[model samples]
Target: MQLKTKSRLKFTIASLLIVIFAYILSNGLIIGDYQIKSLGSITKLGLDLKGGVYIEEEIKGENISKDTIDRTKELIELRVNALGVNESVVTVTQQNRIRIEIPGVYDAENALKQIGKTGKLTFRGPNNDIVITGEDIKDASVGVNQQTNQPVVQLKLNESGTKKFAEATAKYQGKVISIYMDEELVSAPVVKSVITTGEAIIEGSKDIEEAKRLAGIIKSGALPVELVPATVKTIGPSLGADAIPTSKKAAVIGITLVMLFMAIYYRIPGIIADLALAVYIMLTMLIFTTALKATLTLPGIAGLLLSVGMAVDANVLIFERIKEELKLGKSLRSAVDAGFNRALPSILDSNITTIIAGLVLMWLGAGQVKGFALTLVTGVVCSLFTAVTVTKFLLKNFVNSNWIENKKMYGA
Candidate 1:
């Protein structure tokens, strides 16, 4: 009775573990700031799956230097990304135009307006207190400070700004106030006096050119570059909307049929193999969504299906080897161990070669090719684990528990 209880406990624990693993993959995990998104939610569908706005714009100038173009592109990317856009493809074209393709974004006009806004500038005091904001900033100019005869920036603020500045300067007198442009610290000057004027002088430019650059930087921080929209168009989802549902249905049907076949052919071992295969599916989806974050393109789905088939094939190979050993009058335990050992080399060799090919494709290919390669590699690795570790665990537990004593149940 005690032995039976121990066996039941072991089996229950194993079953619970499998259930927990599956749940984790499906529901994901969140601990404080760290989070793992659910498999379906984290897997981003490509532009092919979701229609969006396509925009093309170029920097306004003749013979624009590459550095300037790069800077402009960087700023545009930063602006868009900072606005909470995800998976936005911003690429520079041959004509030096910046093309932005954002999947699932439909409002081109508002998106353009919001993305090009010159971010707010602020003055922060001790403990990161907001001393003053840029609500009343009017114009900034570069000029020579009369007293020092040095190049400086002249800033004009409205009446509201003047009052706030005067109050902050008087309150935080002798303390430091850091100036920030788009959250980047441009300057941190100590307050020397409380002036009630609306105009302020920023001194510290080494030369006229430096003063001009600083003035331009501040002005740009207040006013973003003019974006001349060359073209604004909406693209339909490259893949039809029905593609995902159809692919998912196909995957479900295929996996179900394969599991049924395994159970029918190999009997007890087949059932164990099916369990491992189920785990393989969960792990692959988790890797796809969390680890690689690979977009689920059509080719990606194909690769995943192919890998699933390979996982079944791996189980078949091991089961065949086990059957052969059992036919040679080996004990179930000996047969299982020897079969797995013999199958290991072949499985590793084939999977390793496929993984290498997938890596090569990832290195050389782009777009869907890389997606296919990524899923392919991920699937192969997961299948390797299910075939070797998961299958072994299930088989050992069944045999040790003496759930089935007949070799015939193993398809021997």
Candidate 2:
């Protein structure tokens, strides 16, 4: 074999290896304690599909400012995201009521308990002089006491908080400074001396776990207004289970048709396109399940499907251009190169516009809209990769191997 041919063969083998690795990850193979969770197990499903917790919380007080309501929503979003509920939506209704939907969670009561807390954390001296509030703290973390070997909550103060806390500690040395959560005293520890470093540790936690929990709540920040739970709803996984098979069937059928269309019309090029599309889907699923920590909702599926069409559309555009170039008397390699180059401007313009729209929807939209936007954006990005780089790579290898010198094989 020619050295060049041998190198091409090795490259093909490497490409196949990558595809196999991706397939295993997509299916989530577990080896001993180390496991790659399958896409179904790895990806969470949304409330509409999987049914978890739905909560309607009314903010107390009359005529709450929109700013406060917005702030509350942002805070709730942070809290849910922090709690690993990546797909949860926290939105404000016109009535200023907050609606929260979290999918795939089983412990509704515990979730509610943590989420419902006002988290109005405050640090106060023995004389009840406030040293700082949650807003003044830059960050909170859990640690172990070096001297007493007790679990502690460590707080890092902002500039203003540092000044105030230092003053409080200096003035109230040997007296207790109380840590309050939602106006209830959770701990009171004696101030040892002036804390000039802008850091304080609350050392009365029962254990490291408790200290960590407290730190998480504090990091979520306090709500501007107290929230009273008005209504709560829960859904089971039966809805998701029923929806999956139907969705899967539709997707399988649709992709199969796409695969057939490409292979029939574009011939060998279509087969290469099919392989690229397969890799695109695998990478997209891996990103959705693990990297984004996102759940699949019905609308998310729609987004994925729409993206599949867009991916196919991209390839169609490039293939048509390639055929046009070939008719214009360009060689297969030259036509392939020009096709990609000429098609990129159109492809980028379309995908960029869609991405812009998706971003807008993500910023202002809630629930299903957000899910759709996320999936659409993800799909468009992956499509760009497969349609451009992957397709180009495969075709280049095939051409380099001298496998198809026939003009008819180039869809001529």
Candidate 3:
């Protein structure tokens, strides 16, 4: 009796803790000067969800190879990331055009300035003669100047570039060599000595971030083909404005109905399953907001709802197995253990297959499809844990407590 009392107390404490944690995470907290934003507020929304700018640029060159197109697409992605634009998508579409979607950017001109450059990097001599282009550069990175503790952009040149730079440094020993990107002067560093090692540094950046940005732009290299803007438009948030509230309402209603069904039909075990479901939702959202920093979209919400159903299904499977075990006259504890053991394989088989599909979509799909796959895979994985671990743990504790041992209460 003492052990049962302890088990009951443990279950009560654990359930309350889970509920409290979930509430805090969802609603956030504010105390005096400190504040914590809700998970939903921090989670990034995609172009469709938040509305932003869409740009289509045509590759302006004849006989553009697939490799060139691919390289340009990669550079564009790098440039966008360097601009601190998260959740942006760059894709090579039909008709030799590239499509870019940047969320939360309303100004089309600013967006163009951020990503529309051809990024042609060049080193010009004293008389404005081209010394070398970005093609001869091997790599570019940000480094610190040990003497002044200031940020600098370091450049490494290829063998040909090294020979050319060696000659230029020897000729213009004390003169300045300007670096330009798309005719815009980036830096003008004096040739201190004849550098035969192919290594150079540009030191005039205001801060480390500026130096890193310059390095990132240099590393992205020049676009293989010129890109002409085909279309640039700012997207409105009208769809998202309506979709978000509707999605929240639908989710609440659907989950409430599911919870009610489980509680009314499965009795005590149903209530435990609902608790596990809550934990699953909290865990999945935490992953999206904190761990993955994933961008939520409309399709992603669909994936989330689908995973919720799967979580409920897993609990249903276990409850039905418990009913079968009770019919065989097993004790409540034995039935609970046997039910989980019997249901685990089926649950694993279904969830694992779905996970595999989600991964494939994530690997190959683009834009909204990829978002859907990410959410689906994350939610399914979380569901597996909640169903196999959390629901089982709670049911085990309830049975051990000797609180309700009636077969009917176990859904028999």
Candidate 4:
């Protein structure tokens, strides 16, 4: 029975180690033919750190209305999304100015060319009655018909539009009112009702995503003024290449120093802490890369390193408590249990406060601040798991082994 129990324990530990290893290896070292490994095993690259193109757009239009700024920002975001950059930041600054930051970019001219395109609005009748415009649109959305599960584009009209739509549709029953973008017919909703509620539905959509994009474009409305590019700065791929290596080196050095410090100060418990730390880092990377889809920027890398320091601090507190227990003549196993239980309150308090900071950063901060918030949050969570659960589990198993009788090995 004893042999079987030992074998089961060993199997469980080995399985957990394998799982931990595979998770980290899969994220850090890209496998197969075309996949490339991430530059940071835990550290991710950001746009500013990678040095992408920075474009400043000066909005010069009619009276600078808040709606205009809001609309322009949304349109630019859509355009950026269309370009397939994955992680880009577009925001409005003071004086009718817009800033776009694209990281790891090779070209800026093409983006510049696309940015200035006036998202024009047009409405044509079946007999080419160009009686209305996009300004008449109050709101638009993508929805699904509950009965058929078919996708649709819906447009809600303004007061003036409601009257106009009622008159037009009442007169031309079966005729189509075609919505165009650059002379391309996006939707042609046939006159169904008088549409007095200022709302109309465009059916015949193929999918939900396409319907949503079309709805967003229509709802963005017309630009009050033309957006001209005042400044365009393209950061080359070389810029990213230069900083990536430096950031990687920093991460390696920081984590290695942390591991060494923990081992030296805490003795055998420190080794277990180090292993848990390794697991913590890996779990953090997994959370960012898989769950949040966070773009690992250099600043983000810095935030994660800072969180690592915090994680080690938690272990240190518990270890100090264990040492105190040992001095009181407690057995090694009893010391560990008492130490963790005693330190629990302090660990929770500190981590919870930091998590509050991370939440504030994510809420109020924009662009790079979002990255910082993401890394900090992921780190705190993974660190808690490592310090509280992982270390406890490993220590419990280790204490059960027959050869582990010397209290001195535990710094007793």
What are the lDDT figures for the candidates, one per model? 0.78, 0.82, 0.86, 0.76
Error of 1 at 169 (Å): 14
Give the candidates in order of TM-score, highest first: 3, 4, 2, 1
Q: Model 4, which residues run further than 4 Å from truth? A: 1-44, 58-70, 92-97, 120-153, 156-215, 221-231
Best by TM-score: 3
Q: Over the full model, what C-alpha lDDT does candidate 1 score relative to the true structure?
A: 0.78
List model 2 lDDT by residue over 1-412, tens digit each: 8845974895588579667876786576877899776677767777988778888888899877775676577656655655677668777876668988888677778777867766677778877878788878898888988889999988899998899888888899999988776555657888887898988787778888778666765665677688888978888888888988999999999899999999999997898888888888888888888798787899999999889878878888898999999999998889989988999999999989999999999988877888999999999999998898888888777877776788778787
- Residue 103 Cα positional deviation in candidate 3, in Å, after optimal superposition: 2.1
Which 10 successive residues of model 2 have the least lDDT summed? 74-83
Q: What is the C-alpha RMSD of each candidate to the true structure, in Å?
A: 10.2, 8.3, 7.2, 6.5
Better of 3 and 4 by TM-score: 3
Which 10 consecutive positions of candidate 1 have the poorest summed lDDT? Answer: 216-225
For residues 1-412, what per-residue lDDT tens digits would candidate 1 score against the true structure? 6654666577668767888877776788898999966677777776566777778886676777664555466556655665566766666676767877677877888768755666767878867888777776676688997888999888777788788888888988888888776766667777778868977877777898767655555554544445578888786775548888888899999999899999999999998898899899998987787676556767888899989988887899899999999999999989999999999888889989999999999887765677789889999999999999988888877777877889999978
Candidate 3 backbone collisions, by pair? none
What is the clash count for each candidate, in the order shown?
A: 0, 3, 0, 4
Worst lDDT window (10 residues) for model 3? 216-225
Model 1 lDDT, residue 279, Cα? 91
